[model samples]
Target chain A: MSTSTSTSLTAPTASRVAGTAVLLGLTLAPFLLGPYAVATLSRILVFALLALSVNLLTGLTGLPTLGQSAYFGVGAYTAAVVAKNLTDIGPLQLLIAAGVSALVAVPTGWLAVRARGVVFLMLTLAIGEIVYSAAVNWKPVTGGTDGISGVPPVVPLPGTPALELDGLVYFYVLAVFLLLLGAVTRLGSTPFVLALRGIRDNEPRMKAIGYPTRRYALTVYCGAAALAGAAGSLWVSVQRFVSPGDAGFEIAALALLAVVIGGTGSMWGACAAAALIWLTRDYLGNLEAVAGRGPLLLGLLFVIAVYTLPRGLAGVRLPHQPSRKRTA
Target chain B: MAGWLDGNLVSVVDGIAFGLLLFTIAVGLSLVFGMMDVLNLAHGTLYLAGAYTAYALSDGTVPGLLLALAAGALVGALGGAALTLLTQPLARRGHLDQAVLTLGITFIVADLLAAAFGGEVLPTDPPASLRGTVDLLGHTYPVYRLVFIAVAAALALLVHLVFERSSLGALVRATVADRDMVRAQGVDIRKVLYGVFAFGAALAAVGGVLGAPILGPGPGVDESVLVLSLVVVVVGGLGSVRGALAGALLIGQVQTLGVALLPQYAPFLLFGTMLLVLVVRPHGLVPSAVRT
Candidate 1:
């Protein structure tokens, strides 16, 4: 607790001013940029949430699940269905999506928590693939590969008018992104988060000390799944559609890769990395000169990150800033 | 009765053939992971390399096919050696490091392969000798498939004898049991790792070469093969040949038969089976005696 207080003080004392400046710059970016850029930023923010969820599990809990897309797809589909049938209230839809995703994750996490190491990863992957296949084949409910479309625009906060246009929706997305960002950041600093990190490093010791490791893992998994679900909800709201491909291996893989690139155990790092990855895939990958080489570039990034920046973007020293002191 | 029997039996036969193919590919993965305590995510890259080599070398003749297989295996050995060397720095760091490095290698090799051979799925045809089919239980089956099954089974038997019966096998087993003990006894642990890694890679490439006609050479084939191999290794228990065989056969039947019987649910069925297996037997159906 004292360390937390000291850490908070030190963080602000050193980087608080710079951090707030960056936040202000990001918030005001859309006002200066075009509608196209705003749309891309919104998409990046959604993926950043997804990457943070993956970080919560893989980085903090030491559960390198390759199946976060299951929750993501579930959330998207839930949001789509709700928008289609029940309500277009963005906040309500996000809540329902997260709730449903967490509920579904309970049993899946139970099954997954039984195994550790690579077995855990494989099981999660299998579960994810199963969900993806279901979405693809359950044509009556899911509409198969065609996916569900024409989702209603999400209602802004306080029952304000719906965000009908892309530019208007960006503000809505930005608001939710900031809220979720705060929530996950707080979660990362909690006792549960500390315990999860301990479990990742020394599960046996934690268990020997009488901690219910499996229960802890399941709890973290559910929390991460809920966050992913929230991301999925935002995705459906933004794209105005839902598809089985939302639950595809690529999303799950990219989420984990984002966490890896961001520096595991750092929520902000994951968010930053997710934005970078999405920008690369959406903007850089689409460049005429670099067309069709997105995967090649991604692969090169993976190689370079593994070798050079083992701790990822978070750990990289800023050009002018002094290096942070190492902790014991 | 005859029509029904043929309809059902044909798929059963097909299932067995496909399962055998999977067994050939997955057994090496199980062995390497089980014995070495390393997870080579790049295992499928070796398979892809083999398929590509076949695409590059073969003149579409039986001799060419044989030459392609040999070259594929040779390339696999070289790739394996390279992986061993590349991963040597992280050897002391443990499985996490190995996984990270191999995953990196998977992306690199996959990209390189895509760059070299356009992203298209390069279809590989069987040799002229296997171009035709023969009647089997009232249904015609590809002759190449039967040949593939025979060749794979023969190789499996050879592998069985070498690992299960020979002195080299005992030494390998001993190495798996206790690396420190093996090294203390003057057996080079590094050499054992290199040999096993090479052998495992060669086995995967062999499967790729033989399986290319059926699986086809493609951009994502490497990842798919890797996932299937992971499933097999997990199902069989890591490092256990018998477990890999059993898991492969089971998955093979599920894949081929599921496709024939319930095409819509086929993909889900494979993963569902894996989930069921993991729940029932977390250590897999047949766990390794020397658990890492």
Candidate 2:
């Protein structure tokens, strides 16, 4: 519809400028914001990564997934268990987490990618619920929903001091997030992504053109799961606690909502929407005027966003393609 | 093994009751999913609303239970109509949009119910007359569940007859074939869509009302039921009443008996079962349409 068209109309220069400014804000956040605000920002960055993962499949590849949180949970628990027994190095934990998540994604994503549209959604959702149930019932490994905690603080590097301050931890999360974000952005111009968009627009046509659409879908599915798993690792570093709720339906739904509100396929849009949602949940919901009404406000936000921002906030940005098309 | 079967017969029978309850909820979801392609995530909210209705109305009497069922049906119908109205326009965009919109509705309604009923999971008791146990093959089982199995069996038969053999099935097929032609006949299409909603939502709500004693009304029941029913719908295949029945009964056994037998690996068992069924028959056990 209008969404796909408006998505193509975003001014690249304007997007770069906004992206730079946002990066600056994130880089300087520790010095500017309070400890609590910094912690929230850190969480937002992790959630934004999750939103990016959803953007990869749901937004980019046209496979509606409600199963990314399962990988997220897996990454977190893997990291927790790694920190407990394997290694306390943050990067190592992240690698192991992402690896584990991608491994889990193999069979689950295999089953999921067989169907498209709502059936795909159903399969992924059941996958998420299954993972969530496993997290709760697998007492020996997952800690039986209480999750793993009281681990040694993650050392960002091999020889560095273990991070204890929230500000310092925020920097570590920011670094990995930036790395992944850069990689995904670099992936945008590749022909593989072009194939993904093709699949999204019309799978039958893509298949008729001799493109292996299913493989494309499955590849993106694993990549997205890895990205979500990395986010989960960051989440562990930020909160130092993990729980079954991390892999629950709500997280998957919110991540998918972030992708939708961000304008499907718009990376920065998904990240921005994720931040906005988290702020609404953490700040606006807890504000004295609307305390304990977070879910209500979130619900209202969802309804309004779907109706008012059909093309999403990204689509609204620099909408006038005629004047903004000037090259640098 | 004989001793084990003898000991666990209650759990097996319990699975049937639980499965029937799942059928009531999943049948509506499956039909709407197959026909409309609308991702009604708030379908569980309707069930929650019905369970809450049961909790509010049940005075430990049969009349109260009946009243709760009727009221639950009304509440569910209204919710369904509202959801249909909210989501209808978004369907053209994509299922993702519908998913977001319906999820929003779910969040708003679930929070409202939570605020009204408190955050705790409230236990809803069966009517006084149905409270006692009944003897079955030298084993005692809840009278309400035994009655529920009978009622649900009858209900399932009725749904089968109504959708499969009745003229309504022809009308549905006709409408799906040509919308404008049906509209030309002076049937308000919105009302028909609303009727679809009412049928599906009413069934789910009634399931909630009757199932309140078994599943209870709680903060997270909506989500669990939603997931469970989604499992049933997928396992049974969409738009087929028989599919929903088969899937629900199978899942009911997996859930109850699996828990009773291997408490630790119950979730894996559910996954394994789903994976096995899907691997064998990707369209589910009884897909209504052999779609490409």
Among these predictions, the greatest DockQ belongs to 1
Docking quality level of the chain pair in candidate 2? acceptable
lDDT of 1 at B232: 79
Which residue pairs collide in model 1, if any?
Answer: B34-B239
In the range B32-118, model 2's lDDT, one tens digit per residue, is 776666767788888899999999999999999999999999998888888888888876676677767887888788889888999
Q: In order, what DockQ does each candidate have? A: 0.44, 0.43
lDDT of 2 at A122: 70
TM-score of chain B of 2: 0.92
Which ten residues in a row are the worst by lDDT in model 2 chain B?
A: B283-292
lDDT of 2 by residue, A219-291 (tens): 9999999999989988998888899999887899889889888988889899999998999998999999989
Fnat scores for every prediction: 0.50, 0.58
Point out the worst 10-residue segment of candidate 2 chain A by lDDT. Answer: A319-328
